[model samples]
Target chain A: MRFTLADSRLLRESVNIISELVTEVTFKVSKSGIDLLAIDPANVAMVDFKLTPAAFTEFETEKDMDLSVNLENLKAILKRSKPEDTIIVSLDKDKNRLTIDLTGSGKRTFNLSLIDYDREQQKLPNLKFNAKITVPASKLDDAIADMGIVSDSVALIASNTNFTMKAEGNLSDAKVDFPACDDTVISLGKEEEVMAKYAIEYLAKMARGSKLADEVSLSFANDYPLRVEYNVQGKLHLGFVLAPRVSND
Target chain B: MRFTLADSRLLRESVNIISELVTEVTFKVSKSGIDLLAIDPANVAMVDFKLTPAAFTEFETEKDMDLSVNLENLKAILKRSKPEDTIIVSLDKDKNRLTIDLTGSGKRTFNLSLIDYDREQQKLPNLKFNAKITVPASKLDDAIADMGIVSDSVALIASNTNFTMKAEGNLSDAKVDFPACDDTVISLGKEEEVMAKYAIEYLAKMARGSKLADEVSLSFANDYPLRVEYNVQGKLHLGFVLAPRVSND
Candidate 1:
């Protein structure tokens, strides 16, 4: 398999978002696109990622392949990428190495050793949602980070007229509230009232997807797992499923 | 004692640099200026700092006062200062608390608890140097960081012709060299030969003082202590003295 991207964002940002949850993941690539489904070690969060052929300037494959690679090594190399660099990817079957090249003013290549993980493929849990809200990515990311300053968990609430993110600590409390008509709210869900509590640490990690897109789409229900998705239209889609925290209130 | 600065850079950057060497330091405040002279517990380095009345838009001190405060707590409050914020500092003598107010979009105040520390005053050692070089702060800071990547210590070499910073690791080596004619060198010393080696970690801490000014001044001699100074004339003076490493070379 070989692929060349005009830029590294589709690849770099995806790795950043996924690596926060899992260290190693299998990339199933075919003519359609590259897909990754991974559940973190503690099984509290799962990442669903897709990079279509459109994300790259050029893409080719023999048929289909499954490659399990360490995200840490890949992230280190990606960290070297400047905004001007383009990325090219290939595989060395004999050495079981994933070869990556960043091309710009200079050419830099890295050979990452591939690990053998013959574990069964992960299947995403089937989840349904009753409410969906799409808001600027910073709105959600900043709110999650703000809540982290006050408590370990954040309560997410959505109603026909508003959405609220609230957290309370022993000595401090923080809240981010937006009415349906607020200019920052592109779309507000009308599900009467839906509420769920999620671990702020995981939510904050998942919210980093904001770096990949201008807006984030969130879908959740009362006491149900939340699905956060970041999509750059024809290029890539990065989604996360976070299990809700059981709350007495 | 009471003082208000137009911005926090003079205070913030000084605290950041000094805190890396000492957790606590006494600030000697007088009509002239506020001065701090501290040696790290390890005795490997000393920070000599001064924030003159020119740095503050308002300054008032009836008598000389020596106040000891935890640098860590002061640093935490400084971290919250924004570029548009003006910092006002005053002492609550009865409560032994340092009250700092940040005024900009809104007003925020932090009263940090003070601890009683009565360490004897430290006097800076007097040393004459045959070499003195003033270069752009980044030219020196970036070189120090580059050297840090290769070794635990960096060797500084200077002659009438050129100056060099070099480091060697088991497999890699890095060097930054500049001749007397280099434009980055505001003034290169004309010394036959003056060389010294210092712990890179301590040097790195002292290099952070560069944040206070565009240029950093260096003075040293063969096998002698190194003095690094960052001065925004009329505003503040932040200097560090780092003991040289015992190198066979």
Candidate 2:
């Protein structure tokens, strides 16, 4: 399979986001679409990544392929590729190595040995989320940053009227509240109140890639992993599902 | 007696940088230019800021003004001002309250009470720097970040041939070396070799504000405070002289 993007930076950014919560990513590519899945064991956070052929800037595939690789290693190699680079990926027959070609102002190649990264993909339950909101990434970033200074985990409370992130710790006792009607809030919809706590460390990582998106879509259920999804360009869909940290109090 | 800025963000950022290094800032404005000087007790560090009317995106001042303010409070208030907000600062009759009018999307006024933050503004000696070089901020940031992981101090060695930053400890040893002729070197003008050990914490703090400059000029002599200067916007110049820490060998 071969694909060409306007820039490799786009793909690098998406990988940077997914690496935060998910360590091993399995991508199944077919004629119809590409599907990616992964989960964080302790947090039980998962990501369901999907992209259609139409979303690809360029796609050329002759057969189906399923591959799982360390997202960290993939990120490191991708980061070496400049944004202006054209990227090409192909499976080395014997298929032991995954060869990635980055050609732009310079030529570079990286080969990573694939491993048995497959795990029993658990079926995520369909649950009703009481709140849904699209908030500017920057504002969310600030709130997350502020909360991160105080606590490893942050509680997100969402109602029809407002969104709040709160953390209490020795370093700081802070709360960031944004009204649903505030300019920072792109959209806020709710059927009821929803609250979940997740590791602020991971949330901050996921938010990094969403900066270009006007807003991020968040779905939360009490005690369950939070779902974050956003589109980067029409071609990329980056999502994260982080398991709620059991609150001490 | 008064001045206006096209945007408050610049002032906020500048004040933030100064406050991070020193507690107070005094601006001695004259017909020739404005001189800003700050000193940290224990003589660990000091900042010397110089700006002329041409430095302001816009400038209007009739008489000389000498004012000292609690930079900590000023930074806190400036942080609340929107980036695009127009900031108007004027001296009040009581000479205690500095009226700050921030108007753009909305009008908000702040009365900042001045403080008696007095320190002798010493004319720093013109030390014979054995070495000097203009290195990109990002490169220095990367090195300092790595060094920070291991120790509180970093040893810098600069010569006509190379520039290196190293930190050694039980956790790990980190070093970033850039050959004098390396492509990353923006410029190299040095007379002799210079090497000194200084606190990494202060270097990191000083480098934080340097994102605005393409390169920062560093001058050093044996066992003296490291002098860091960044020419911002071709007009506003910020300088920091940090006393070297004597670490137990």
Candidate 3:
């Protein structure tokens, strides 16, 4: 398998988001695109990522294959790349190595050994949600960070008129209200008021995808896992599902 | 003592440079300015910093005083300041605390307790040097960082024609040369060739002052400690003396 990317930033951003949740992942490569579905070790979050051939300047595949990758090692290699660098990735099947070539001011190639893991692939869960909200990615990221200063968990509440993120600690509490008429709220739908508490750490990790897109879509039900999706330049899509924290209150 | 700074960045930068060498420092405050002379625990380096009353927008002092400070604690408080924020510092001598007020979007104050150290003040050594080189601070910083990738110690060589920094490791070696004609070298003065090896870690710490000044003056003898001086905006002067490493060659 061989592929070339015109811009290396998308891959870097995708890997950054994935690394936040899991250290290792398996990539499914086909003629159409590359796909990844991984659940974190704690089983608290799931990541679904896809990059189409259009995302790359060139794409070639002899046959479909699953390759296990260490996200940290890949991130280290990607960190060496410049913004204008073009990246070429090819697999040496016989040698069980992946060769990554970065071309910019100079051309450098890194050979990373492949790892074989005997683990079953995670299947995406089917769930129904009562509320959905689309907002600017930065707004959500800021709210999450701000609320994080007050509490370890944040409550997401969606009503007919507004959506709010609230966090309360022993001495401090923060709340960010997003009304339906606010410019930050692209769309908000709810049949009734739905509220759920989620771990701030997981939400912050998911928010790392904000680097990939200007807007993010969020969907969830009352007391259910939250779903976050970021569409990158119409070519790549990154999604995360985080289990809600079971609160006593 | 009371003082207000138009911008807090200068103080922050000064503390950053000092903290790189010593965790604890003593600040001598008087009507003229604030002064600090500290030697690192390892006795390998010394930092001398002075900020005149001209550097502060408002300066007031009733009497001369020496205050022992924990640099890391002070740095943590400074890191919260925004570029546009005005900082006000006042001493509560009766309470043995220093109150720092940051006024920007909002007003936040932090009161740090003063520590009493029984250590005596360190006297600056009177030494003579045979060579002096003036160069861009960033140029030297880059050269040090680049050479750091190759070895733990670097050799500084100064001749009438050029100044060079070289580092050699077991497998790799790197060298950066700044001839008299190079833009990075403002001036080079030496009657004869002089070379000395110094610990790269200490040099890197001193290079933190590069952020405060465009150019830095380096002076040393054939086998003596190196002196680094950074004059900031003609108002603050930061200097460091680093002991040379004993080399077998």
Candidate 4:
């Protein structure tokens, strides 16, 4: 299997976000593109990532393949890709390794040994969300950052007309409000006022998906796992499902 | 003493560079502005910094004062300064604290407790250099960074015609050459060829002075301490003197 991306930003961005939650993952590659589903070691969150053929200038694979890898190693190599460089990834079956080539002003190639795969990929959870909010990913990132400044856990409250993220500390607190009428608020809906608390650390890591897509959809329910999704049209999709920090808070 | 800089960049940049070398320092403030001379805990390097009255918009002081502070604390406060903000530093003698005021879109004040000081400031070293080479600070910074990738020590070579910085590892080595005719070589002079080695860690920290000034002057002799200096006209000066890593290498 081999693939080349004219711009490695989507690969870099998505991999970076996922690597923050799990150190190792298996990317199931086929003719359609690549897909990966993995749960964090702590079982506090799960990540779902997919890249379609449209994201790559050239993609070729003979058959379905599971390329298990240490994400940190792949992320470190991908970080070396310059804006003008085209990134190529290929499987070296003879050596049981994966090779990354950055081609442009200079061609630098790095080979990373593949890891053994014994665990099953996480299955998709059928979640029934009571509320869904769509807004600019940057807005969500900013809210998470603001909450991080005050506390380790943040409360997300969504209603028919507005969304609010709030965090409190021993001496300080921060809040970000997004009214449905705001230009950046693409959409908002809720069966009732739904509020849930999530660890800011996970939200901060998941918010990094903003680099791949401008708009993000947030789906949640009262004291239930929250799903945050960022999609770049048909090119790629990166999403995370995070367990709430509290129960019926 | 109290002073306000239209842009806090000079203070922020110089202090940040100095903080990397030493954790604690004493700033001598008077009508002339501020002066600081401190030696790192390892005593492998010394940092000398100065900010003339020309760098500040409003300067006022009735008497000279020695303000001893933790560089890390001061750096944390100054890091909050925005480009559009004016930074005002004032001494709160009654409370034995220093107040930093950042005024712009919002007003924020941070008070840092002053440290007790009984030790004398480091005296400037007096040594005549056999050679001196001046080049763009960015070029010098890049050289130092490249050398850092190969080894923990770097050698500096200077002659009447060109300057070179080289570093060698067990398997890899890197060198940067700057000819006298190079556009960025502001000046170069030497009675004879001279070379000296210094710890790259110190050189990397000193190269950060480039943030305050684009041009840097390097002076050293065989097995002698190296002086890296950056000056922003009448605004400020930040420099470091690093001891040789090996004698006559």
Q: In model 1, where do residues sit more than 4 Å from their true spots? A: A1-249, B182-191
TM-score of each: 0.54, 0.54, 0.55, 0.54
Candidate lDDT scores, in order, read 0.83, 0.72, 0.85, 0.84
Which lDDT tens digits does candidate 4 get at residues A42-112?
Answer: 99999999999999999999999989999999999999999999999898999999989999998999999
Q: Which tens-of-lDDT digit does each residue in B81-176 have in candidate 4? A: 679989888888897877777776434556667788768647989977887888898988899999999999998888777889989998999999
- In the predicted model 4, the residue pairs found to clash are none
Which sequence of candidate numbers ranks them by DockQ, best first? 2, 1, 4, 3
Per-candidate iRMS values, in order, are 7.2, 8.8, 8.7, 7.7
Q: Where does candidate 3 stray beyond 4 Å?
A: A1-249, B182-191
Model 2 over residues B1-249: C-alpha lDDT tens digits? 676877665567778888887776678877656788777665788888876666555565677776777776677557766777787777775746677766664344555666665666667656666667678877777789999999888987776678888899896988998887644442334545666889987888888766557678787766666888888775578888887765554
How far in Å is the alpha carbon of B140 misplaced in model 2?
22
Please provide TM-scores computed only on chain A for all of the candidate models, following their numbering.
0.94, 0.86, 0.96, 0.95
2 or 3, greater by DockQ: 2
Minimal lDDT window, size 10, model 4 chain B: B182-191
Give the range where candidate 1 chain A is weakest over 10 consecutive residues by summed lDDT.
A182-191
What CAPRI class is candidate 2? incorrect
